[model samples]
Target: MFYKYKCGNEIIRVFVWNDDFHNEVSVEDTKTQKSYDRTIREDENGKFFTWNRNTIYLNDWIKISMKELKEKIENGERITSDDLCQAIMTDGVENVRFIAPLNIRCGFGFFLNGNEFKDTLCKVEERWNREIKQNYKIVLIPVESDDSVANSADYYTEDFVSLIKCGNIKIAETQKLIHQEQSNEDYFEGVNDYFDGTMGV
Candidate 1:
């Protein structure tokens, strides 16, 4: 069976399959392409057993119902990214897994915009830094495809040492640093080359 639920501007698809021995479920966000899959097995006594269940994390909170979120949207309420973050924090949820954006490929782990909510941006930076400190080789990439977004590249720096010690630098600052040192016509290409050179790639 398959079901579709709308949450604000996003669509979530839920798929389920069952047999005499086991049941499988998959939930996917059409907007972000983030997904979770789970399976449950039936025992001899006809009781179901599962070691783990899939969950949807809105920020750090585990949101149990897409139906409720859809209802709120249908009722003409506006749900912003900040609202999602607030819900997660207030719900006292923990151990949430981070889902990378669909546009971001492997080797890069985070994408931040200059227009993001300040608190949400700070929280994400903190989480990424913590992962870095734990020896995760996560790279922060700042994207600027146009003049408006490119203007924000003024926030990131190329000082990797400072970035390691302080995780607050923006991707724009790094771009600015690269522009100053290199004469590449493509800003992103310059940034990519910088990292590649640093990594000896």
Candidate 2:
């Protein structure tokens, strides 16, 4: 089995089942089905995706990890994300502690830290379901990286507990997409709709 990550213009499909140690990474382009002989270290250096110590590489935006942000303050550098660039320095922080990430999927790879952050809750009302059946996607605030590393970081994993909100999977939205062959006509038909056809979904 493998997982797909939208990095830059490539839909990196990392095949995790390969036991061949000769090549640490067995990756391929999802569209062309072409494979590459590479190592995780190479990918970490932009052969694919960089394995960063503190920044997160998202498809739309880049985010800085909390530890990296704190170091920026100590070194005195401009921040990347605009969320709390000035707020943290002006308002100041106290009693900072890292919490295991609340979100499992696209939430965050870095551990969540709270200095003055507070949690807010909203009741699951019947009104939402009346209009749309899907659950709402919650927005989160991640620390910004300093200007120095902002250019480098473009933007991963796991477990523990939950004391905040609860959710159940919507089986309807969990459908798997099966690949279908498309002819030259069907492929070029939507050229006008997409410029380079490299845009990530």
Candidate 3:
């Protein structure tokens, strides 16, 4: 089963059912053309959208595709390419996770929303009420010069601070999460490694 959407001129197809486990395609707003903004526009047309492959309607105008892939992106899953446009648009830089450059040659950056990302402690909705509250984001570098995603990094090894460590307060990777419930301390422990930590400063 697929969840389809029509946003402005874009056509989004989501591989929903994991029964056959085809592709979760967790990324959103995928257009035939790569050029897309997360904000849904209501005034455009010329695209087609189908839901469950059962229902589809048409608006009018130009039916054009935006992306033609000549090659597949390596490790793009870590970049969260699906969420990049929206995250950048909303100033929610803290919501992105960095793994690598789109290409060492291409300055293009994408966001990877891994299966492990959403349920991670950093993005958890329960934070605002916690004592050491913070928004966590993952960076691949050694340290964040400041709090901005572009300059931030939280590199770590399993149960060890390999290089850079930044969070609400300082937390070591040695702490293990034993509590079935995620307490305040357990929250930080969840991000113990760079996989890792989301309890950002």
Report each candidate's C-alpha RMSD, comma-separated, in the order given: 18.9, 22.1, 18.9
* Of 2 and 3, the candidate ranking higher by TM-score: 2
For model 3, what is the error of residue 121's alpha carbon versus the real structure, in angstroms, after optimal superposition?
17
Q: Once model 2 is optimally superposed onto the true structure by TM-score, how far is the C-alpha of residue 10 displaced, in angstroms?
A: 3.9
Model 1 over residues 1-201: C-alpha lDDT tens digits?
A: 343334344555554442344355566755568766655444444433221232322222224332333355456665432333333233222311122222322223245453442211111232433232222223322232322222121112223323322334321122233455576566668678797895345
Q: Rate the local accuracy (lDDT) of all candidates.
A: 0.35, 0.30, 0.28
The alpha-carbon deviation from the true structure for residue 92 of candidate 2, after best TM-score superposition, in angstroms, is 34
Question: Model 1 — which ten-residue stretch has the worst lDDT?
Answer: 148-157
- Give, for candidate 2, the lowest lDDT window spanning 10 residues: 152-161
lDDT of 1: 0.35
Which candidate achieves the best lDDT against the true structure?
A: 1
Best by TM-score: 2
Flag regions of model 1 displaced more than 4 Å: 1-70, 93-100, 104-201
Provide TM-scores for the models. 0.18, 0.20, 0.17
* Model 1: residue 170 alpha-carbon error in angstroms: 26
What tens digits encode model 3's per-residue C-alpha lDDT throughout 1-201? 233345345655543322332322332443343322221122244323333332233322112111111011222323222232222223233332322221121124234323212111222112222211121233333222322123222322221121112222222121122232347666667667446454463
- Models ranked on TM-score: 2, 1, 3
Evaluate residue 104 in candidate 1 and report its C-alpha lDDT on the 0 to 100 scale: 22
TM-score of 1: 0.18
